[model samples]
Target: MRKRGVKSVLDVATGTGFHSVRLLEAGFDAVSADGSADMLAMAFENGMKNGDHILRVVQADWRWLNRDVHGEYDAIVCLGNSFTHLFSERDRRKALAEFYAMLKHDGILILDQRNYDAILDRGYSSKHTYYYCGEDVAVEPEYMDEGLCRMRYRFPDKSVYHLNMFPLRKDYTRRLMSDVGFQRIETYGDFQHTYREEQPDFFVHVAEKEYRMEDQEEGSYGGAVSTARSYYNSPDADAFYSSVWGGEDIHVGVYAHPAEPIADASRRTVERMASGLGLTEGSRVLDLGSGFGGSARYLAETFGCFVQALNLSEVENERHRQLNAKRGLTGRIEVVDGSFESVPFPDSSVDVVWSQDAFLHSGNRLRVLEEIRRVLRPGGRLVFTDPMAADGTDLSALQPILDRIHLDDMGSPGFYTRELIRLGFVPTEHEDSPGGFEDLRAQLVTHYGRVLEETERQEAEGLGAKVSSDYLTQMKKGLTHWVDGGEGRRLTWGIFRFTLSEG
Candidate 1:
């Protein structure tokens, strides 16, 4: 194997520091981060023997990788069941997401998956008793609230022993990385890395994915696709978003746009309302009218949750589809097309129905609400934010305001709640946005500054210059209406969180 001008490497889930020592010995700058303190300490000691400034190791979870630790690696390695340790489908994808987020554009994610044929319901000595330094190391079944799993540990000379064995079918892990935007994702074996399934000890694999500008596209989500026209007719939409958010990777727009950052705010609000809504790890969520795919990503990543991100625009779905692919979150983040009225999801498919500020575009509010109820698992949550009438009044007044503001928007708080209850969905929570769009209007504009000057230069071009004005104008008036309106300023924004009945 050629060294190939590679300089640094990040060893994820690095146990015992063996990889770090080997890299340091080979004169590479190795930075290792792991969740196990005991394992990391061993890595530290092992590195120490090779002189003072050897390796940098930190204790961290692979699911939410540290920004400082990722990026620019010749190799970003996760071996054993490190990739499979994510507790759930959501966690698995989140781990892949963070891993992709941190790795340098051209880096490799080398990890192994449990070859079911080599382990589960296979293996000659069904109960092979093994000895590691004279301590017993066994792999067996154990069930927790989470799921079924296997654990193996060696005692006495124990350093980083207990193997937290997570068995993921080979195809499962393979599809996961592929969907997560790994361009050249492939499987290999120990040392030789042959794809053969004859090995019983363990499987060795490596995934090398190239990062390039051509991978960027408009309205692409979690790496999924849609029709061509739905994408914004950007002379350079991808470039513009990339300049602000700072990545050529899949979700450059996620951390790029200001409204998207609301994902964090949404997370905060939902977490507070979580107790009332009764959502546990098993909950299935629906992100109605999913935008650039940030919230769906957040719900899946932060809550160890699953979300069906339904949207109308091909562009929006495309953006989210790709983002999911990049983050390895496709399993937990499903991007469905068609508006709320036409959702094809089977009845009782969801436990929590959530929408951010994107619900205003739908036409039939009652049928939409009814569709939500039909799809919700009993007692499932129906939570979202909408422009509410400042004072309980005619739906007429709200229509004009929403018209100037744009989209098929209009629904007073009274009308919305009544519709929810009418549909048999328990209206769990609702409130007028305290600040309305007034605060966000300013915040959104401020967020448009160029992180990369090329973005500024490009936006300055002739046709592109006027593109953002309309969106900004609509936002400004919308905010002014709610902010400066008299005592009962009729329109306001709000957030909601709720649950589905276990029955």
Candidate 2:
């Protein structure tokens, strides 16, 4: 909750006041509310008993909660399998709507449900671990169906209590949250991210009300863009890439020799792409997905062009700004924290758009192309290199790589050529023929292989404390997949240069 910036919370299902009291103890401003006055009374007493704590209690029905409870909160927690108590779909929807209305714009709703699917599909069983941990007491589902799950609880004193609950399936619950305008819903099994479907006794869902790019349709690549932003912003990623690929260049290198330094080879690829741009002093260039502003600095120094280094990672952008200041190129380079999918610049604002091995990270390659076209002046150059899947290659064969990158597909050479032309871009002088960079399919096995070797060497010499062994292992596996894919002609990497149509 602290990590997510939650400072105030509403415990909508305070139950015996356990959660609400805990929230107050944890230094969060919390309000406890329950539909039943008895529950609220007991919760207030429990709060007092816990630590002389005073809990602000409210008697409110979920459907019209705001009528009694006022003020929005950063988060609202409906826990202890309380949501299933609403038998009708209309009631559930109404309650969720009320919760949505009672939250700040960036607020979150944390709801939990019993794993009724397991009770219905497989028989009811409990490890007595997560919930209902009382010894000499047994709780089981006496009767269960798609609509109803009747639970029976027996105490040590031979007393029994029964409750009927709506059997909410995991996917159905997620769908309900989505339908209620929750932009993002993340579910955890017994508070664990990695758990079998039927293993968890409860499923906790954290739904965010704020709009995010990843909430877009699957093909939009919003999820992939979000993943890339998070990955690059991570400390380990920043450290590893900065150390291995050199502090400046983090993209794939076009090696003249297998033994060439990674930074030099990478700069060579950047130089090759820039050669066709015809950039001049004061020319405005936008470097999309610029990682550390290495290429931006080079363009500023070599061609005297002003560059906007647009990237999604704040960590990388901070480093980029620091480097620009160090090299006295801060005046020439402006680091903008943004995604290429939605360029934060005005239309036709740039003389050239430059990217290297970055477009593959986009889920919606076509949208990126459109954005490039929108931002480039007529006859402005677009130079980029992406690690692409070979044309007509089966995507199923690249599942491992795709899973690692959180993308559905990679753009092929054919796809780019068609998209560029469709988006009013004409091949530049750098094109080998009208088909553009067809023969520019450079192999990446050597690049990834060299990276892996250098990474391992750096780790062995104790130069990479931030890079964990698990990260290294995953990196090695991912790099091997790329290497094998390259060797089998499943992947292609190279530079492409084009000019926005003047007409």
Candidate 3:
């Protein structure tokens, strides 16, 4: 989403500062505020520099958004729809009231909403795309329809970022603004300015706070999510995993917890990515969507290169820091907190933009490739993989259910290739590894057996709390989906190796 380049920007609910940092990169006098201390720390570190262009990150909630601001700004943006996280109508209004109070009366307020209709149609899983920084990403946006959209982001390090968004209908939001004292409301299908009826790629609200507040409640407005004493470290640690693929286990790739013994399955996938990437000594690279930063670390230590890994998760950053430091290669790997839609580095910054299976989390795929092209020097190589639909299977019936858990911006493989070519990269190589999803079926046999064995051990020690109910549910759904045809056979992994042709 693009902004009108306002001089001053207060990024409300700046989770991990991904959007906030981008504002700085886009040349705004930006300051980010969020309720989460952990999130603020991540953004503060990323935006810590002086001058008017310098970023100042604050710890504040959406409801108290105006209180934290001593004066008004030219613009205020509540992206990631950080508003939808509200669980009820009252909270939504409360947040909106704060948003209104923070604006300079005529200043613009832009926020986004997940297109519910789109989610009910696509199911979670995008045709994966390769990106910078030895990482690849894909999405399975989850829709609870409880007015919430759960976005699942899988990274190259096998780590995950679950974005829990509460989506409100455009009509409902329009009225909410009217009632909450915001006039001049304009709706777009995202920042692209597509109409709402078109259900454009995304739903965005561009509204102005009314100068007259006589009829409105005189109170605070934009306080977002609060990071209390205890934070939910795992987005779905207890999730049952029963999504649109419902009651079926669909394994697109193999991932073993870093704590777990390296499965033979995990090893094979890693080898494929590493080998296909064609890494050589003294390689200099940028890694995007670098979940746990393992792939970036691998490139630095194994290939003797300097690698920069970027991710949005504070928890994952902590883990990656440990991994990089333990191997005595912390100096070789620089982990930044930001998003690939807008990488923080300058033009032509590296020799290789290595991303593997981590770009899927992006809301826009074309912009991702364009950004990659903007950062790479002439002739720099881009290597990555994405698990995607082999064909546009007529998944209309099951599509809605599946997509609710995944968003539409998650483009297909064909969609990805077309965009890459459209973005001006020379066509290099396109290949798919089939049946990898099939081989994953055994995970039920293996992962289940391990769980059962653990249960027995616990029981022997006089304990009965066995497998988590959600874990069992997810595995069952995954198993059922894998052996089925609707979404399974269509599932496949693609490896892309492209070159940035000399200008």
> For model 2, what is the C-alpha lDDT against the true structure?
0.83
Give candidate 1's TM-score: 0.41
Per-residue lDDT of candidate 3, residues 1-503 (tens digit) = 24444688888878877788788887777878888989887776656542223457778877777666567777888876567788789878888888777777568888776555445433332212211123366566654564568877789888988977775655567668767887556655445432312324456777766453322321211011011000111222111211211111211224464223223443344455556455666667888766566567657767787888866544456667877888898999898866676677899887788665556545455667887998888888776665444457555534542443243433455676677666666655535433211223333334334433433444355321222223334444544442343234444445566778786
Lowest lDDT sum, 10 consecutive residues, model 3, at 221-230
lDDT tens readout by residue for model 1, 1-503: 13445677788877887777777777777788889889988878877865654567788886667654645666777864567666578888878877777666667777865444344433323223221233354444443212434554445555444545456755457567766777544444334333222343434445556643332432232212211122221212332333333332211111234434423434443444343455556879887777567767767777778888887654446767998899999998888876676567899888888775545544456666777878988866776665455446554555645555343446555566556655554534434332111112322222222222333444455323322333333434544444433224545544544444354
Give the residue spans of candidate 2 off by over 4 A: 1-52, 55-221, 431-434, 438-442
Q: Worst 10-residue stretch by lDDT in candidate 2? A: 212-221
lDDT score of residue 435 within candidate 2: 53
Best by TM-score: 2
**Shift of residue 103 alpha carbon in model 2, Å:** 10
- lDDT string, candidate 2, 397-485, tens digits: 99999987878899988899998998888887644445567344444777887887888788788643344444567787898898888
Candidate 1 vs candidate 3, TM-score winner: 3
Task: Supply candidate 3's per-residue lDDT for 466.
Answer: 20
Query: Which candidate, 1 or 2, would have the higher TM-score against the true structure?
Result: 2
User: lDDT values of the candidates?
Assistant: 0.55, 0.83, 0.57
Where in model 1 is the C-alpha error above 4 Å?
Answer: 1-278, 394-400, 405-409, 427-479, 485-488, 497-503
TM-score against truth, every candidate? 0.41, 0.65, 0.45
